[model samples]
Target: MNLRSLTVLGAALLLAACTTPLQPGEKRYSAAELLALKPADLSWPATSTVGERALREAAVADIRARLVLPAGPEREAALPKLFDLVAQYNAEIAAARPLLLQALPTLGQRDAETQRALLTAAHTLYATDAAPLIWPLLPQLTTSKPFAIAAYTLLQADGAAADRLRVMLPQQFPSWADDARLTALMQRLRPSAAAQPPLAELLAAPLRPGFPVIVSLQRPGRQVMGLALVRDAGGRFVRDGAGQLFTSPQLALARSGLPGTITNGNTPQGLFTVVGAGTATNPNIGPTPYLHSKLPVEATPAEFEHVPAPGAAAWDEALYDSYLPPSWRAWPPIKEALLSGRAGRDELLVHGNTINPAYYAGTTYHPGAPQQGCLVSHEDWDAATGRLVASRQLTLAQTYAGAGARSDLAGYLIVVELPGEGAVTPAEAHALVMAAGR
Candidate 1:
């Protein structure tokens, strides 16, 4: 071959070496062999949208090819991707049903991580005909004690399953009924008749002393777009050049489209402490500076609220409870961050999207993209020059920096679900802030 052609071939080989998974050999892995691969190792190709799309198609094909194999660990490996695919790419595997149903009977024999994946996938596919297989296993699954959390999470996929969970709760898992985390989940299962505290009440609730608060008001529906309103430390709503409350449209849906309670689900509704600000290294998040924050268990309540936590204990349910007003204290869904943090969810942030818009063009929140349980704002980047043309996240970061007392760019973020069908308007948000007073 000519020197130029040889050089082109060398570059292609180098690219392949960098992007493809390296194991014992280049040949396809058996179901059992693939089990040894860590979930992290199964990540998307770290290139451009083309690379992402290529890996997605290849991974989906690989999973489908393995699904038809005889039932075993391959099924376990394939199971999680069912949820992952739907969550990340909105792609539902057509071949998962038979494999899932066949594997359901023996699901209890698998390990903890496998069980979690199965339960998560079962929840994702619950709307399909997998309910029968899942229902029978709920007793066995919940009885595992260790897996009861996953079982409870699975039931939450459908409201009809709520009654079943209620019946099983007292009998099957009495001890956890009053536990804060379980209580939060149960309240989600069956909402309370008590009314939501007025907007003014939540706004007036005590928060961290030094930082501004960004209140993200989303719809009860997780997928709908939401609005975030910022309140300065002095308790006044920040306004824009238009003299209206400064608001940014944000989406809290997880890339996996799972509920916030799950590992990488939607953004949980509750308080988060914005401890600092920095740019994300993740390609999906691009170069935008993210408002770094922590969930309840991830940071002590004392640290979370920028106050002295009385108890010697790092954090407890009561300490978490103390931050909210009495009205919000009774609300179950508000405890999601506390419970979710305890469940090992972490790394949630407020950042801007750098994902290729073409990928999600027709979706519900097209201009905005779902994150891995972080708050996402819309951004327009000039791809050719790799410069940010416009960014809501940078604007937010500026707002936080402007309001915070310290150099850490610290603040508070409260995510609340409003009882409505549409995005919270600037007028509605401004009026609510006005009612709360400075």
Candidate 2:
């Protein structure tokens, strides 16, 4: 071959060596090193939309064809070959992260039920990197204890036995949940789950699994304490009140803004029947709360399923809307101030599609903003039967969807369970109050 041709051939070989996986001691290149390579070093092949990882993967296929594996060599000898381009692999994966997160809304919402598949792709695509982006569970996702247990298990204080759960359960569970100790920890959390303010309401018609809800509260220094929990159906609680708080559920939701108001999304703690869900309402659910949705859902046998993890698929069956629910025939429309949940919308409504007296009282609504499309729960109930009736109070709030304040001073507020016999906690009583009946 001519000298120039030979040089070109040599460069191609060198590029091939840089894009594979190296187990440990092999020549691994960090993202910095890969970026420093000459254009000619790599084949300069067309890139994929999947970002760096896909690029590396595509390039690796070309390079691997030239390599030949031995029939039965010792594992150690073949190791370097395995990773000759290890750095490229790592870099590609790293680069793909922001891309994945940016495109998440489109991918995640294309179909709500398919979110798990999207998560799986996220797992395979991002791999270990996803752990740090630890998500806090949204109330709807609390329907599945296993998923909740597994998610909390992800945030191990350190890589203890508790951290190992990510790998054990069906290989589907994050290794963090596999730790025997962590599993025991999850089991321990069960007892306290029901009494926890969020847990009890979460148990009632858990919806919107996998959606993210920001739960934050201001601490002593104006420093906010909060967690972005993922929505799960497996709300933590056992029959007799003993369970673990979701990784940071208590710390995230516990807080108030003013001494006596439900500030921001700081839901007052207490036994709250998830009255119903409805449209986005601000300064309605909590004191000066952000715009959010609400829906009322009575647990239909179909909506109430036992799942290993809380997911939308759990509700794929019929809610039996065709048949009249025992309390189906009649109920008064909830008034504007009450909290009702909307089945389709998956949130507690404060008003049908309007703000409440509280927002006006609190000055949360900007005069020109037209109340920002907030809603309130109605005192909706079925009195037609004369006795207590099982009704699915519903509403839909699109709180985060609108342009509204994202952050507010937070405090440990709780939904105080009123006179009826039910679970109530200290925080709930002190910071929370039921909306004046509609």
Candidate 3:
């Protein structure tokens, strides 16, 4: 058989293996059964009509139910099918946008929950497939909380798009017009006599040549789900070969547990470098063998001579400097304190957790779970037994840690707040080129 035929045959076999004999009176669909479904099976109406609204609602409900099933091979197998269905659902939404806009004349009249669902659909569709149709709707839809968050996120990922958004900002965010931070960033974004590189290119310009991994956490806040992106060897910030951005499959990082902060539970934003590495040794969560990269808060200025401090115009650097040892300079941690300007604590690390395997192993994590200050991988559960266990987080940690062992790949980790509400501060945006002699 040809490749196409072979692929179809393999998929059919995989789907077949996922099924089980039905138990009498068991109304719920088995995980395998769900995996066997296709986008066509969802019965989404082909055309935009009044009936399409109910169909959209019912389809999302079905997707969510299947998503909550115990994480396992079956669930994993089902995700591709589910994702396909989501793509179809999103296309339907995109087609129905004109109707959706006409039906809901004002943001106040739209159901908050439904707006959230549409926002989520747009985010999922764009992040994975780079669906272009949703772009025009994003600017107008920002009146909704969810839509605003997603639009900001999209702008961060595609810096070139910011040029278009700069024009719309005054209309979309009139109140932010006078905001100093926003104004500064807008000025920087203005087209100069000499053409400017896109933000993504500007961020990538500083990296040492070859395959160095850069992990960026954008807009990590109490209610907002932070996004993480990986810069692979090809210099592309992508999740996989499937062309999806690594927005989903991210950890709901803990709110700052630090006392006396703007948002007490907020995750502090800043540019951080990996200082050390190790594995978890806790007895209660004993012997979870994944690699962990340490972001020690107390590194001295002498250690980072290549990295300059923020300029005089930058935000409060003194506060970040306070987190360092007193023996270090009394000034801020970096020359520009960006998100770290207000940071009062340290010992932040990017590591996997073993304390609650079940919670981590599932597709999502409990946002309320506290952390001293760390970036963790989303835990994965076993497919067959539906038991919480070690997940892809361990794999990623191992991969990153292993890469760090190589001399050429040894690089810094920088954390910054998302660029909308908090503009990318000077400290956060500086080129992170590694030391030359190394």
After TM-score superposition, what is the CA distance of residue 302 in candidate 2 from its true location, in Å? 31
- Rate residue 207 of model 1 by lDDT: 73
TM-score of each: 0.79, 0.17, 0.36
Query: Global lDDT of each model?
Result: 0.64, 0.25, 0.37
lDDT of 1 by residue, 60-159 (tens): 5544454555655544554554445544444545556666667666766776677666665555554345566666666565533324445454555455
Clashes of each: 2, 128, 13
The positional error of residue 417 in candidate 1, measured at the CA in angstroms, is: 1.3
Measured over all alpha carbons after superposition, the RMSD of each candidate to the real structure, in angstroms, is 10.2, 25.7, 18.3
Q: Is candidate 1 or candidate 2 better by TM-score?
A: 1
How big is the positional error of residue 186 in model 3, measured in Å on the Cα after superposition?
22
lDDT of 1 at 346: 74
Identify the candidate with maximal lDDT: 1
lDDT of the structure predicted as candidate 1: 0.64
Cα error, residue 295 of model 1, in Å, equals: 1.3
Model 1 ranges with Cα > 4 A deviation: 1-71, 142-158, 178-181, 255-258, 307-312, 383-387
